[model samples]
Target: MIIKPRTRGFICTTAHPQGCAAQVRQQIDYVRKQPAIQGPRNALVIGASAGYGLAARIAAAFGASANTIGVYRPGERSGGRTASAGWYNSAAFETAAQEAGLKSFSLTGDAFTDETKARAVELIRKELGQVDLVIYSVATARRTNPRTGETSTSVLKPIGQSYTNKTVNFHDGEVSMVTLEPASEEEIQGTVDVMGGDDWQMWIDALREGGVLAPNATTISYSYIGPELTQAIYRQGSIGRAKDHLEATAKQLHEQLASGGGRAYVTVGKALVTQSSSAIPVVPLYISALYKVMKEKGIHEGCIEQMYRLFADRLYSPNANEVPVDEEGRIRIDDWEMREDVQREVAEIWGRIETSNIYELTDLEGYRREFFQLFGFETDDIDYEADVDPSVEVPNVSA
Candidate 1:
């Protein structure tokens, strides 16, 4: 099978196994080159098959020699159609872990369910005894409450007032202004329910109850705080409300972990092209501009670099340098990215941006390439025309 990207919007229906393997290998190579850092010996990564979650899993297994259990939603390959990038990513990670003599298992199911949590806990007890680090990185637009059997969807619109901003179709490099209506009260609440910290706290409570979290365990969840240009649509929007809930939940989780010397922290990361971010309006343009500046400044990093830094420098630094936390006790890497200087420069460039000069001011090309690379489409080493098996099985996939 020659797998390629089949996209509707912000999602690629087909994925390439070989290409995903290449991506995993590339991340491992990057980790190998970095200065050695000590990390958790046993770990569990929720949303562990794609984007930042996948990078965290790679870091744990390769950078720290940790035994890891990954939870993700797997896609089925049908009729010569390839699976989702996550499915292929899991396969690649499992293969790499085995080759490196590390224990790794991937569970395919909903991470929000009690049954799933029980299965994960059972696996941890039977295999690794307890997890020293838990990375909560699930990013989904919808989730069904297993307890009530009620399905809910999340909205990413702004609150209080409708927002209109310049956006780019990174796919085609088309720049345009987009106007998004404000989210309703119900929409805001639903978004909070889906993306907020409730599920994260639930996971922690379940793990604690099942004795799956080791003493002095540390848990981290990913967050984002972009520039003022995006504040209305992001940090101060519907999704922002959800992030607020998540940040607050981290404090509560910290209290819950106090008895065992464990702690929970939310690490706000820089904007990058991911499956989730592409769907948000105005973000593509902002990411494009940010990428240009960061690249020029030699500070551009992908998911792997960001996660590696988070673990090596912030989470597991030997010197115990206090991870820079905001007043809310959440780590704020994105704050550096959202500094007044950076935002002002970006805003200036944004105002001058037109279709003729957009490329000069933004990394639109880079964004498109990364987006395609997520589904294994625009990679260099893979022979896309070569015959391959779409039904390749992921090792240690719990049925």
Candidate 2:
């Protein structure tokens, strides 16, 4: 059957397998061109199907020749309908990894649950022995606690006050002023529970207890801190409180790993248009402006570029002097993207932006293109009319 993008609001119901394969190929090629890094040889990546998680898996596999275990929630794909992008992405990645003569396995389930963790540990112990690095890059709106059987949802709102700002709908490139109501105390707490460090801590503790983490192991989680334009909706918002918990969890993880010369660090990555980011209010406008400025300055990076730099430059670089870190031992690559100069310039252009001048003032067009491309929607190389197989199988998709 011919595959094309089928969308329902923030998510696409279908994905193009060939296009997803092409995307994985492109990322692998990019990683191969860079200088080699002596990174991990065995890795575990949670949320390892899309966004930063997928990029991290690609970088580790291609750049460092690491064997990886990817854990993600699987989506339905049957009949002539295409699967979710993450499902196709995992299939494409595993195919590529096998062709490269590297070991890779993908598991689809709730990563926050004990049963999934046990299955992962058994696989790792049987196949890879121990993992030298673990990357946690999950970004979800809701989580059902495995222990308590309770479901929690996260919100994207500011902490102290209501925030009003100009936002854009990227779908139609319409600019409008919007006001976001303050998050209730329950909302705040729920957001923290869902997006916070508890799940991360659970993963680390399980890996540690299972004796699957190798000595001198390194663990990293993805975080974000955008410019003031998005502070109300992003940083300093309910999500920000969750990030604070995540960052603090890193400290505890660091202590746990210290005995083995291991370390845990949070890498605050730059904002990019992912499936998760597109749903947030007011972020499309900020991302549009940021992309225009960053591109003009020749500093724009996609997920692959960001993850590559995170590993080669920050994590695996032999020279400690070259590694960038915050005063708290966390990496702040997003801060570099949200520099004062860049924000000032973006604000100037943002103030002048209207529906008439949005394309000229910001990269709204580029942002929209990227958003669609995430689901293998608008790629020039893909022939949407061609008969494609929807029954593609990941090499090792454990139940």
Candidate 3:
């Protein structure tokens, strides 16, 4: 059975195994070409199959040469349907890591559950003993409570009032105004439950109890703070409230990790095209404009580059005992994305942009390409027309 790219709404329903492997290889090659990082020796990356999570895993294995355990939920082959992009990505990642003589493993299951957590800890104990770094980069719409069997689905609506903004259908380059209603109190809380740092703290507690975290271990979760253009629907919206809780949990967890001289922080990352980010309203448009400006300025950084920088500069600074942080005790890698000149130009384009000139005025074409790349389509060198097996094994994981 051959596989190709298919789409439904913001999600690509099909993925190419070879294409995904190529993408992972590109990222690994980039990391290998750079100087090695004096960072974590052992790492665990939750949600480690796509976007920032996947990049974190690659950075840890290739950049830091860290033994890594990546925990993610990936779709397996069903009949003729293709496996998810992450499945192939993890497969490629595990194979590459092993070839590089880096110790790494891949676990597939819901990271929000007690059983999955236990399984991960068991792997960490048996495979790597303990991990010095944990990267929490989960981006999902829903989660189920393992203890209560309660299911919570998160919404990306505004908090207090309705939000109306410019949005784009990246597929057709259609730009239009989109209005999102405010979220209910319950919905807001549910978003917090899923996206907040509760699970992060739980992971820490479980690792601590299982003695799977090394002394002076450091953990970081990714967040974002876009400009005022997206403030109402992002930084100041329902997701923002969830991020606030996540950020606040970092402080609490930091104190808890103090016993082992460890630290916890939330690092705000730049907006980029991803399976998760493409679903967020208004962000695609904002990112399209921002990408155009940043690319012209020659400062565009994708997930791989951002994770490389985070590991090389801030997370593993010469002063290992103290990582550089903001006044609020968070790391800011969105510095370039949030530059005054970039934001100023993005805002200008955001105000007067339209569908007729979207291609010329903004990087909508680039955004579209990245969107396709997320699902293993539009790759430069892959023979998308070739016949390929839908069932590609993640070398480190039994499938």
Candidate 4:
């Protein structure tokens, strides 16, 4: 099979195995060249297959020399259909980790279930004994409660009145107006249930109970608080409400583990092209404009760069005893993206952006390329026309 990107709206249905391997290698190479991190020796990364989660796993393994176990849900190739991009990504990552003599394992299933959690705990107890760092970066629209077996679905909508904003069709660079109606209370709660911190707390509690969480361990989860331009659709929206729950959970977890010198934090990250972000209304356009401004200023960063910085500069720096954080006790790695100068330029671009001048004013082309690249397409040196195998195995998958 010759795998190529097949898209329907924001979803990519096909992924190239070699291209995904190349993408993983690029991040690994970048991490290997940087100064080694004096961080965790054993780590567990939930949702460690794509986007920021994958980058965190790479940084922990290659940058800090940690043995890692990854939990993700990815479809494998079957019946002539290609595997999900995350599948290929995990396979590549585990292969590279083993080649480098670093212990790595992948467990594929619903991370929200008790069975999966129990299996992960068992793996940790048997293999690594104690994990010093836990990274929770799960992003999904739906979650099933392990306690109740009830499923909740998250929605991307504002909480109050309808929101009208300028958006772009990255497929064609067409800038237009999009109005998203407010979510109902039930819907907002549903979003919180799915995207909130309950599952993270459950994971931590299980790990601690299983005696696999190392003393003075640290746990981090990812979040986003974009500029005011995207407030209505993002920060002030239903997802924002979920983020509030997540941040609150961090505080609770921090207190729970405080007696042992353990810590929990919500790291607010920068905006970039992600499968989850692409689904939110008006964000793609904002990111396009943001990319243009940040690139011109030479401060643009993708997932790998941001994760590496989080580890090297903030988490494990020479002065890491006092990790830099904001008033709310959350790490603000999005500081550069939320810089005043960057926002000012993005605002100016927003005011004058139209379909006729979208390509001129924003980095829509770059956005499109990166968007495709998420599905293992648009990569450098890959012959998309060549025949390839769709069934690539994740060599270290367990349970």
For this target, which candidate reaches the highest TM-score against the unseen true structure?
A: 4
Give the better candidate number (2 or 3) by lDDT: 3
lDDT of 1 by residue, 148-199 (tens): 8877889889899989988887777777878899999999988988999989
lDDT of 3: 0.89
Model 3: colliding residue pairs:
none
lDDT of each: 0.87, 0.88, 0.89, 0.93
Candidate 4 local lDDT, 102-139, one digit each (tens): 99999999999999899999999989999999999999
Q: Residue 50, candidate 1: how far off, in angstroms?
A: 0.6
If both were scored by lDDT, which would come out higher, candidate 3 or candidate 4?
A: 4
| TM per candidate | 0.97, 0.97, 0.98, 0.99
lDDT of 2 at 380: 73
Tell me each candidate's RMSD, in Å, in order: 1.3, 1.4, 1.2, 0.8
Off by over 4 Å in 4: none
What TM-score does model 2 achieve against the real structure?
0.97
Over 4 Å off in model 2, which ranges?
321-323
Model 3 — TM-score against the truth? 0.98
CA lDDT, candidate 1, residue 382:
83
* Clash count of each predicted structure: 1, 0, 0, 0
Please rank every candidate by TM-score, starting with the best: 4, 3, 1, 2
**Model 2 poorest ten-residue lDDT run:** 75-84
* lDDT digits (tens) for residues 291-354 of candidate 2: 9999998889999999998988789877774457888778977865878888899889878999
